[model samples]
Target: MGIRPLAKARTSFAATFGGLPSGFWWLWTAQLINRACGFVMPLLAFYITEELDRSAAFAGTVVAGIGVGSLVAGPFGGALGDRFGHKPTLVAALGATAASMIALAYARSPWALIVGAFVVGVTNNATRPAHNALIADVIPGKDQVRAYSLNFWAINVGYSIAMLSVGLVSFTGYTALFWLNGATTLIGAVMIATRVPGRARPAEPTEAEEAAGGFGAVLRDRSFVAFVGAQFLVLTILLQSESGLPIAMSLDGFSPSTFGQVAALNGIVIVAVQLPLTRLYKRFPESWVLAGSSATVGIGYSVLLLGDSAWIYGVSIVVWTLGEIGNTPTSFALVARISPDHLRGRYQGLYQVAWTGSAVVAPLVGGWVIHTWGAGPLWIGCLVVALAAAVAQLGIGTRLTRRVATKDPEEQPEPAKSAPASDAG
Candidate 1:
């Protein structure tokens, strides 16, 4: 059969699916579904502590298992994305994640739970580098920041809906939450496998580029390395919002439901504010934006030390959410800008590692600090980390902006004469 016209194909596809560039929709939908499924983590501590009769320390260990899996899988996942392609790897990882979630629902023994958490972590981390690299491949340079911002907004929307829905599932049972989580992951997998276009490989790598060593080259770049360290610290502080906040709430006489509200507030603020402010901030240098955001987040967390009241906690959430919105997209844009086209997957994967590695260790350390010393010490430590990250990012961001500015304007690729009219099969 003769191939249909691209425009006709796009029109039909848009009519059926509500958009074309199936790639963009696919990525956004996958994020939405994956995040919706991920809403279970906040509840997982409750399930293990209240339902399964596990200790706080043990529950923290279980949660950390996911991070461990992610760290283990991250580099290899990025390499796979570079070697093969993002679409297939993402589909397979999502499928694996779904299975892991289902297994987690059924887990009775601690070992089973740990294994399930690890699998989920690994698959979850693996999906990100591939997803990010694919976006770099498909989206134009000027549009990339907005695209990542939109993706972040979609994630929060999904998370907000999931948090709201979790109350209904609690009535059914905790296992039901796991099942729902698994189903959502499956939906993401299906969407990506069927709809997302695969990334096109570049013609070839130059000898110098190849000899410099793929991901190794990225690691070797001094400024990039600093940026990664800054990212690590930023995540170290942010992860506390997930692991430390609940403990702080409990110590102040709040119940599990109240803790859930606090968590939901984090998502709600991100969803409500991220898109509106993204455009406003886009004009600023990314370095200033990142430093300002990190400082904002640090200030927010520091404010938590002032009191344990619900309103105080709520205010803290709002502050951190704003900082989060400011930092996330800009950071990703910087990474996309610095990476060579052929090694984008590898760099994205490495970026995932910085965040994931922190996620694994930060909670364990934060939990221990809270258990042994006090919330004050933990929050104080977080503030210090944030300040350090801001400082490091200032330097990194300055270097990145300078690199972009100094590049020969004539050597830059000419803008595409016209937008590729349609993203159709």
Candidate 2:
């Protein structure tokens, strides 16, 4: 609360940035630009209802299209990165995303918009697996945790700026929003294409290697599967911010601008505290931090039941934002740790499936529930989901790191290893 914790955080912050590669900053820059310009998803529900005069159920379906895109793209993207390398995969995905956003922006009909949404999801969402593989390739083992944290920090900083801007732009019209989104995505693509050099893809696995580990390898890893599933449960509720919260706020007579203000609370909180939270979380067991995060996120939504005022919503956002701050970097670091370096892309892609599933299903389920049962029931349902996610996360902790268990950032995997570095930086 005082200068003492802030001072310590500043010290830890310096340590987090020390010794990272130059390429990482470029990656971070692209992330900042892409997210900074990200405008569509946050206000998508409003665009559909207020701008397009669509039903909430139909809006949910459109949002679900994004999830479908991520689901399809995530694994394919990871495989493409595994085979073709990271830089090219990133360039293609980002370029395709720009085109999809442009398509979505111009689509005049509901069916067209729905198809555009799905295309956006496919082209855009795969960026994660490609990105994670690149991080593993460029960064040394010791710095993976902080590297991912810094990358995530870029995402939210841009996200905070984008949300605030989108809130204001909503007053003007949505056309500009789509154009800006596509432009920024194109810019990010250009940066990576021009600046970031490519790494060679991993050699194909031998027959023995294929039998023991390959495409379906991650699927057979029980602990990793559990971790991804727990993530699915929690993301379902957290993603509700994209659609559920907006819908609820509008029903309460709030404007999209007000929704932007409330949602900005999340990005603001993360940007402010991510460094300190990183420092703080480094002190605890990763499992404990992740479990606590799941619990906190649930509690944040339950707070929604208490009131519907702007300040109330803001406080709820801050509460869950803390959970987000802790959960995200920890999960990324853990994914890097548990995943053998050779198959990190596949692992990340598989892990991403949990989030993809949530994005695909959460909005549809939440919207249907809200439509059928109203706001109160939706809040109650979030509380239930939260409990389930927390338990599942806690249970997975006992089995999380069977192959590699070093918690210190100083540790490094041996050289000339097999797929262990497949997830490499």
The per-candidate count of clashes, in order, stands at 0, 16
Give one digit per residue, the lDDT tens place, for model 2 in 259-283: 9778878877887888767766665
Compute each candidate's TM-score over C-alphas: 0.82, 0.82
Give per-residue CA lDDT, model 1, range 1-425, as digits (tens): 34668777776444333422557877887898778667567687788898899999989888878768888777878877776776777778878878887888888898998888888888877888888877766666666677788788887887777766777654878887788778888898898777777754443578988788667787888887788888888888888876788888888999988987777788878776687677666656677778889988888888899999999999988998889999998788768767777677777888887888787777788889999999999888878888888988877887775564454323222222331212100
lDDT of each: 0.77, 0.78
Each candidate: RMSD? 8.2, 5.8
Residue 186 CA error for candidate 2 (Å)?
3.2
Give me the candidate number with maximum lDDT.
2
Clashes of 2: 16
